[model samples]
Target: MTADRSVLPRQCRGQAGMPHEAPHTAPPCCAGPDRENHSGKDSTGSDAGSDAEGQRNQAVFTPDGLTARAMGISCAAACNPACSDPELRRLLTASGISAWQTDRLREVLALAAEASPYYRQALQGVDPASISARGGLHRLPLLHADVLRRAPLSLLCTSQDDVARVVTLDTSGTSGRPKRLFFSEEDLNATVEFFSWGMLSVGHPGDTVLAVLPGERPASVGRLLGTALENAGMRSVAGNMGQGAPALARLAHTEKAAVIVGSASHVRHLALAWQQAGYDPGSIHTVLLCWDSVPPAVAGLIRRIFGCRVLVHWGMTETGLGGALGCGHQGLHLREADLLAEVIDPVTGTPLPDGQEGELVITTLRRRTMPLIRYRTGDLARLLAGACPCGSPLRRISPGRGRTGEGITLPDGGSLYPADLDNILLPLAGLHDFEACWQPWAGTPLQITLYPAPAAGTDRTLRQQAEKALADSPLPAALTRHGGTMFHVARTAPQAGFGKRRIRVIPQGTPPLNSGESYHEQLP
Candidate 1:
């Protein structure tokens, strides 16, 4: 049966006058298409209105639409202080454009040109006036991880006095060095607003949310998400998944949270623990999976265990929380107001047409502290042309294939990625935990360490499952079995510092690769 769209529980309404509170159930002040007011037109040609009453009513009355409406109001209230003016929403709705984009781009460019030595040197001979007009990111040089680590953090352009917070992001620990990013007061506020709005697309206001991300101190994403939830009248609790699943289960039960957000691996760990304790997370309304890809099999298992909707998202540390998120239609909708995303040929760096697969590149339009222009993400994906059915004007990126910078080069000229190996092994039933390591000889050899499911009760059964998974692959035949685990060696392994584990593809006689080396040195 279709859920009713007009009924609202009293608790969901929250305190009056709060922007994050659910819209009042009262009738809308203006009458127009879809019972919404026509104050102006949005970029997609949708009508905007001064009907605060109408928006409030829609937030509580429509089950499917309420969450999204509440989220929008919350974001509008938070970001309006820094990135947008109070009239910004009305202007966007009426004019069909976000004024923040124009204003932010101007501010960021001015900041970069004035304060950033790196940008000043890189942009030499390039006219500032014509920079915006130039299309395609390949025109700009790629910002490698090493450059970011060695450069002064102040090169990000924001004044140290205006900076409100600092966040250090470690990319899988494979880099061995983490990069620290600075956030301005405006940047933090804008991020909170964006996340508040995005969360509403899938969840209702005042719904409790549980977070299971890394770090004792909240990550940048976590802090903004928590603020957004509070602004929307929702209570949130940050749980440490590293402390193990039992701890997370206790928090979820105590908090009675409606949604859980974290990596799929972390969530799966908690789910297995909950199952062991004979507790089912049926009370959860949704699960927002981030960081890593969620396999189809795992998605089903999570849904079955939690009895909640599962949503996946994609983004990077440099972009704040502004990234693409999947809607009910299973299509990823990019936040076009904040970023311009593109896919290009990995080898030639030429832009690829829509629907063609290539490396993903991103340019931040809203970021003021660090405006990443044509940053090569090293992720493989394709851009989808045309509008989404959800009525958003944002761009979309198809599901990515493998890690951009790290992959094993096979003898036959084929490539293998840790992501590819994860996809292949994660779905198998008897598998518990596994790590892939690459050792190089004449060619790279892949060594996989398998952790069998405890329920299997026998090492022999686990070994069979492991061998079956590697049988058809181009791995060597001498698969070794140790305890309950099995190791399979392949002809090509990942490069040093690429895999999450200590997997080295450097030839036997070659020296170990260091973090100080550039991408060119490794590739050549």
Candidate 2:
């Protein structure tokens, strides 16, 4: 949603132009000699009208204060002066991202043309300098995920020995091969530096952070985060999801951790375990939910259980493990310096305006190895339309809705996302986790299997609650307008692992019973 324009004065109905191939006569937003003109209002609490022409050729200032400027343009330097974090303040204070990104894009394209086989052919007739000069990077073709899955080596700019880390992402439920990401020492250090500064949004120096992310492997997210926390003058305790919630809670209590970082589900499980054992939260004042899209219900549950602030982190290994960090406001601040983020139509690959939901595409600016150019991240999100309430000038991406590629189609041809179910079911008091499947051949197309918490057991009340919530929800309710069994909720034995959750759609002609699920009778 855009900002409320009513707050601005009558004379503050400012206009701004978007970036195009042609150069602008007026100075770009925040780039001119008189930087003060970028401010919406002057010191006397009046509309600064003289700079209207310059502002007209620049980014839009919406009611909620979102600056819908061109991608890669840094506005963080115009952040509210009340900011406290020195590193964050310094990071935002630096501007001139458009020129910087142009230079970096040229460098990346040249390097890709010279070193990478995939880009050598993809960019065969393309001149790196001309490409950046003509229509910006948007004119370039999009790099799809299938390329990485099929041939990761072709995209690698560095030799085997120079690579410092390799992460293999599983695509078990999907048809494609698993994707492998290669990173160099320089790439890894850049991620560490980003984490050190970005983490300050939730933590400070001398604070202890309990990280519930995988750290056993070298250059794993948790290990790098631990390294970053230490670099930021904070203590770090790293653990993996494999270590049950109870053990992590004990570690948190023992170390008097001031911050906790984990996926939403892991943190929710930990909060439930901590509550069950009656453990005091102690020094824990903030929790950073990362590695996955956080459901509001899950965030609410964690906040209530621990009485701490909940922030979200959005990124993938494809983004060098650092994309955007939340400022506990409207949306996550884009990593504009190192990563150029753009929102594009998921189907057509057309760039969309800010606040329009689409596939998030990114291009790496600083990475020397395996740099991504116009890479399509299949997740559905958008650029936020207004300034962050916290007053940071960095462009922001709307939080993840769900993966467009993984959605399940109902019998009525409506789409159902795992996040749709997560938003409704995961918040139930007795539920620990759940899995969804599409079985159109069955009496009901939608099937949800609920796993109750260890202490909660397979209570009939929980089943009733799930049934009620599903029936009342708009998505499921709309599906049943045709008048058939809308959905079925069942109780199941708890699963061992908590890997990335997704909807399992039984392919056509496959017998539902042979899908490897041990189903019990539907809960009464």
Candidate 3:
């Protein structure tokens, strides 16, 4: 069920584009592909991932078993003519995505029309196959994320037994309803295959990779990450992300992990932990960030400490995982062979031109179990029609911004995303770390604190570091416009509910937004 807007805590209410401060407001309701649900099994009556008994019955997930399994899965997905081999490589690394996208659009519509109840009703009089990929897709309905969250089963194109996993995602809102998304084994294999391809950017087969994400279940996101790494000829180990940075540093150091994969905050925490322990972080070869945005601050920190390249992997729990990866080039190269990406005006639901910032909508060209056609991701990004310096032909995208629903609402109807705010702080060179929080304000000024990450020992340089960090930031001007809010440079990370990858902190007990999450509930 969608959150009841009428009873939303007063604090959570807001005007047209922003939700007022909702305490524990969910992660923008814009989670990365399976990012949150990567851990544990889906509550589908039977095992959602691999079942040992079924494991014996099915050779697909096993080592020597992949040949026939892979062949079967491939045959099941109606071959995507546009995204096929040599042609797909050209699309991902060169030009022709526009033509490729047109073909993909046709495929997505056909599948949805055949299987989805919602889409069938929406497209009753139309033939999905006849719809033009170039100028025709807009005539079809755009699927909102909230609709998938509400009546997801109505969107299914496959039978229940064919569903391999059901990911239930909880968002921040007055309502406690979590979005449930289904996937097939083939859908999951597509993700693993993408992971293998992407790892080629900065990894090798023999690398010992450390995965510092939450969850310990065998089917957790971390485990899946390890499996993907293993597929690429690397070894992976999942460790504690909640244990703060120190423990992580020691583990990485002890295990001699050549690569580390984590969300932005966890990576930052690892860097801090290394600094505190005087553990030389430069040993790690590379750092991979997923699920959350990496402010320049985070990228700078990881590079400085680990002496490694910082690569970003973009995907949503909805898209499965690892849909796009960063090249040494300016932006990211998409997994064009599998997922189709589009930029659009969030409000108008109209497609935007390349290089223009807009909401990201996705369609799976390879998925068969539960296809997402024109699914609005809620995260912000832009397509780069130009060539990547890395010489890859694949179309690229800007690292997406935080969820539009997660914006920091300004009093004058303006708003700032956590990413926008982070961009200001991330470039500050000297600070070991910083945490942002919104505190209670009885007056007109919005009270925000920048907690300094002081180091241990009596002779630490945290004060000097904090001062330099403040010097780099504009503070009041950076945070406030028209003198409506006040900013303070405090010296600590918010102790509560900061969660694994959260950069923005909303103080506890703050009432939720009055308008709440009703804005996007029209997905059906």
For each candidate, C-alpha RMSD in Å?
A: 10.5, 12.3, 15.8
Cα lDDT tens digits for candidate 1, 1-524 = 11121122233323211244445442232111122121222211222334434433322211112222322434322221112223323422312323334344455656676778787777565544444412423455665556656764745776577666676656663555677767676666666655655665445555788877543444356666776666555677887755656678877877888788887666776666566667656677677777666555565566668766666777766677657776533346666666667788888888888889898887677666767766677778787777544443345677565556677665556666665565556555555556654554523245455565445445556556666766654443322211111253222222212113223354466543332221223432
| TM-score, prediction 2 | 0.78
Most accurate candidate by lDDT: 2
lDDT value, candidate 2, whole model: 0.66
TM per candidate: 0.72, 0.78, 0.72
Scored against the true structure, residue 20 in model 2 reaches a CA lDDT of 23
By TM-score: ranked, best first: 2, 3, 1
Q: Per-residue lDDT for 1-524 in model 3, tens only?
A: 11122221122122111123222322222111121111111111112233323312211111111111222333211121111122222223133454555566677777788888888887777766666534666666777877866799988888988887778777654265678888777766666655643553445445778887754553446656666665445677777755656777888888888888887767776776676678765677677887777676567666677766677778778888656776544567776666677888888988899989989888777677778877888888888877653344566788555766676555566665666556555543334334444433433234334444454322124444444554466544544454434344534444422242232434455543322121112211
Number of clashes found in candidate 2: 6
